[model samples]
Target: MGALHLMPGTTFSNAEELGDYDPKRHASLTLRELERYIALEVVGSCHQSIHSGLGRPPIAVWREDEGEIPLRLPQDRMRFWLTFLPEEERTLRPDGIHLFGLRYWSPALSADVGRSKRRLLVKYDPRDMSRVFVRRPSGNFVEARYADVTLPSVTLREAQTARRTLLEKGRREVDMRSIIRTAMAQRELVEVAAKKTAAARHAKARGSKSKVDDGGWGSLRGVDSSKPVPFVEDAN
Candidate 1:
């Protein structure tokens, strides 16, 4: 990522520019920023670069090849998209399918539990690990969600991060439940901390709230301004 490259107008650029090292910067960049950076490379600078062997820009070559290439589209778009998703071969047990320390279950998968001996092809979306698509022997995909329906959806990165954090905290084995619990706890703590920070900032901005002067003698209390009568010294 630290590799140096020449830009269209700039003298040079470091790929590591995408990495934020400033302490003031957030822990992670937003997905939109990441996607934009990827798009910039995939369809912008990289495609515009001239290919040495082809004697033309990659984008020009792609445009020329587009007309000659046959576009074969699948009848089922869902399956087509599923084919591109990350896949893993998992055994479907009577209880359900276990993946990434999470359990997934679908009523359709129950009947095939004892009947099939082959491992089923499972595909999941990294954006939402709450559900997965399992390919059946009949060539149809069965959808399954979390075994614990109450569990909130989590991203693959979040799940991995939680696992690592738990490990660092001396957890022997981290599971999906523990990951969810940690996420929930972190969210609550963040909310509380944010409120406290905001309140403190507000108070600081307004300065001390303790009242000092009563704004001239017009606002002074009667008792506070009252003078004591002169003491009489008549032998007593």
Candidate 2:
């Protein structure tokens, strides 16, 4: 199949008047906007215009033609489209699924355990790596959503980076299970540290409050520890 280049003409050309053209100037339009303008206006005009070579309007000739045109898409077009999708190979673990820094698990993947092959194919969209599709031997794609294991504050990029950094040490081949286990352990440690930091801040705040009260009481120089203290009456 040959490709046809469709371009929009801004104005009618006159060879006698070269002043109509300016070499330094070009159309100030984005590619998308230009394509839209051409499709909506220029192409429509051309379709209705009588073609000098064909002796008929392009649309009329196209409609009146009796020969068959290839309009149907191929059955394997989906597979071909999927060929461009980024592939992430992962093995299902007993605990759950983990890939691209975020942990993921589903009942379908859980059932895929003990398969004849240990490795499973995972196809993901680069635009949104939060979910992936797992392919089975039967050529069926199973949708696997992202696991909710990461903290709400953690972004998708951060999650993917965290796993990438974990897996990228010393160029040694790493097992999926071990990588996930280590990552989970590290995550737990981080959680514990975060909790400890929060608790420490709370304790410090409480201590400061106590200290302020103590300072207020201690600032009184003439307080008699042995004497019975009388409560101050409100002057209501």
Candidate 3:
């Protein structure tokens, strides 16, 4: 078992010789593919395999140890969930809570507005940028989602990329609406590009099967991409 350690966060490192899910070997490894590979590796194999130090599979050891003591659960599950998410200090303006050039608001936060000007504790999940947890003066956590509810949810990386694109286009100020539009447009182009690349690769590996999603790239078939549209310009 050489270097059989689990990777941290979003950076997953495969075993030295695993044929499947090797990023270097499988150049077209997608996010979904990584998730499926991890699910199989950890639950299907690792849980059933024997541990060198424990002398037994982890699941077996966990079951045997369960009778020793009862695990204490959190009284408030919402609070417990927010405890582990990434957090920051943010100002709660009348418009809403601002973070990463996006604005968040909640009906629960209306009562506290103008009472006092103080920075609120904010917690967010990086995977979903649709909502954030804000700690009010009363010390209770409230969900503050995007002020523009119609806007689609995007990851932190997507938002940042959109912001950078706006700056590169000579836009002095980048707003939330521009970020959303640019990110979504960029995502569409990515889907198209990925399909084009996959079609070329499929010609070579036609005999082999794949688990990647088609992701509606078929609709983009034969679409002319000679002149791609630029990112959404700041309307200021």
Candidate 4:
């Protein structure tokens, strides 16, 4: 499992502004619930904007624009589309200047069954600023609009990136262990071959010495037979 920390001050926009709302009254919803709501809302909106023949409408008012609207405080938990604008382009337009599509406010904790973690996932199209997707655990999906007013202190991207990094690190660790095991097996094979060679050499030396002793005994028996034959003739 992985975790991400959402910092405050992340902002997003949508086709229409969501009216004012309070989070204190609805404290009954758990943190996971809130996260799910944001994810579903953002992803749905992005998909609609891109694929629903909407001609890529402007989702949110850019922050840098002169007439950009300020998001109301104590926001409602409504879904909205988000996009990133290059610094150069941000200064050009007010309402229709977002670069990457799909943005959403995420909570601190949520269940991500896909990755087995409570993390947020954001998918956006840089080419089409209208198509964006956000995923969370709430089971609530919002498309092409702002979520019900909810103060979001975290950005979805940060959470997703952190989770990815942790998973990659874990994989590297597993690979290292496998390499060590393979090296150890190779070393054991070398030791076994050396022991077998030493035993064969010792056996060959012993066999040679036994053959020499047998040959010496045979020579001695032949020489003694000559003396035995002379004693037999004298008796006859």
Candidate 5:
């Protein structure tokens, strides 16, 4: 299949520019094949650019201003939209593509879990089919919306191997809840400290103003005392 290279904000004027393009050739792809193609094209772009440092510019398949990429497919087949990040942004971490994430939208919810927010959804773990509809908040996995997949059967040894791979890939050791809680606590502390500093500044200003007013009153008292003795004798 010919590669489709889409640039952001540019109109794809040349359907002919898709050199040796043959839609009929891939027309026989099954639903699974199409899904796999979508996944591979999107994730492969990200992985190659980010991890490999292969000096390729990221292609923006979906126009950002368009809100979402609209895909029209046969009613019987599942359809999805794929978007990828730029090469430079993708390589900050080992699992940067996974951490960065992608959105998957389906017109009909899959049979696994029947919660119907079939509009737009994000997935972090592309390899793990079980993590199909889970959402991430700020580079951390927060919650799963319609998680109803059975765990893949694997031997204990295989599970251990997978765990080791995760650790090596910088994907493991994330205590998301603890990290969020600590961040919140730190933010609250900063806010409280700011309020206290402001209050102290106001108090200092008031104290300085009070001292100036007291000095003015003292001067007035001295002048009154100097003039009071003569008025008091005349009244007597």
Candidate 6:
């Protein structure tokens, strides 16, 4: 047994040392060639030729115990894989389950009027948003179809990205509105100040004009033209 182990182990390790072990060359091999090489030249030869301590060829022993291997159907495998997908807690809204702005509903969900606003675990595929699976109270996943099928296809990734982009745009619009309001308020203040300054200047000009008009009367205060009786002549 030790002699047999030494030979096979040395052969496998030496295969990598050979020039045929180039990864690029190996990758270029077709699937048929690869499979044939693996099945015939690799462990397949060992399984068929080598005998274990049980005194039977490794492949024969494996064949005898084939029933011990678990056989899973395609649907069962899918179910098993889906069970591990990440789930989100969502509520059933009036329109249906809203995920990334898209609504999803099913006949089962629509039939239950009392389920509105109820929380459920939802699992969806990023590659396909046309349908989602909701974990029902019975601990089973129920398929939910998109409410509007006429629309373009939307993946979960696209939905999330669009939602984020819209959110950012909304926030930007809010900030712009705030800035516009502040600018408007500042403009109003400036306009009010300008009006007040203009009014003050006008009032001052009016007062100065009135004083100038009254000064003309002051020049006539000493003049008494009605009692003038003598003529005055210039004497050198």
Which candidate should be chosen as best, given TM-score against the real structure? 3
Candidate 5 has its poorest 10 consecutive residues by lDDT at 85-94
User: TM-score-based ranking, best first?
Assistant: 3, 1, 6, 2, 5, 4
Provide the TM-score for each candidate, comma-separated.
0.53, 0.38, 0.71, 0.16, 0.22, 0.41
RMSD of each: 22.7, 27.1, 13.0, 38.2, 29.1, 42.4
Off by over 4 Å in 1: 1-29, 32-73, 173-175, 186-236
lDDT tens digits by residue: candidate 2, 142-187 = 7766565342333334455555666576525554444445555665
Query: lDDT tens digits, residues 132-183, model 5?
Result: 3322222322223212122332222333444454456686563323233333
| Residue 34 lDDT (model 1) | 58
Comparing candidate 2 with candidate 3, which one achieves the higher TM-score?
3
Candidate 4 local lDDT, residue 31: 48
Q: Put down candidate 1 lDDT per residue, 21-94, tens digits, no spaces.
A: 23222122245565675666666655676878888888789789988998887888998888789999999989
lDDT of each: 0.71, 0.56, 0.76, 0.34, 0.35, 0.57
Model 1 scores worst on lDDT over the 10 consecutive residues at: 2-11
- TM-score, structure 2 vs. true: 0.38
Candidate 6 stretches with Cα past 4 Å from truth are: 1-78, 115-118, 171-236
User: Roughly what TM-score does model 3 have, to 2 decimal places?
Assistant: 0.71
Residues 32-102, candidate 3: write the lDDT tens digits. Answer: 67667667677666777799999999978988998997989999999998989999898788888999888
Per-residue error for 69 in candidate 3, Å, reads 2.7
Clashes of 5: 0
Q: Which of candidates 2 and 6 is the stronger one according to TM-score?
A: 6
Which of 2 and 4 is ahead in TM-score? Answer: 2
Error of 2 at 176 (Å): 15
Which scores greater on TM-score, model 1 or model 4? 1
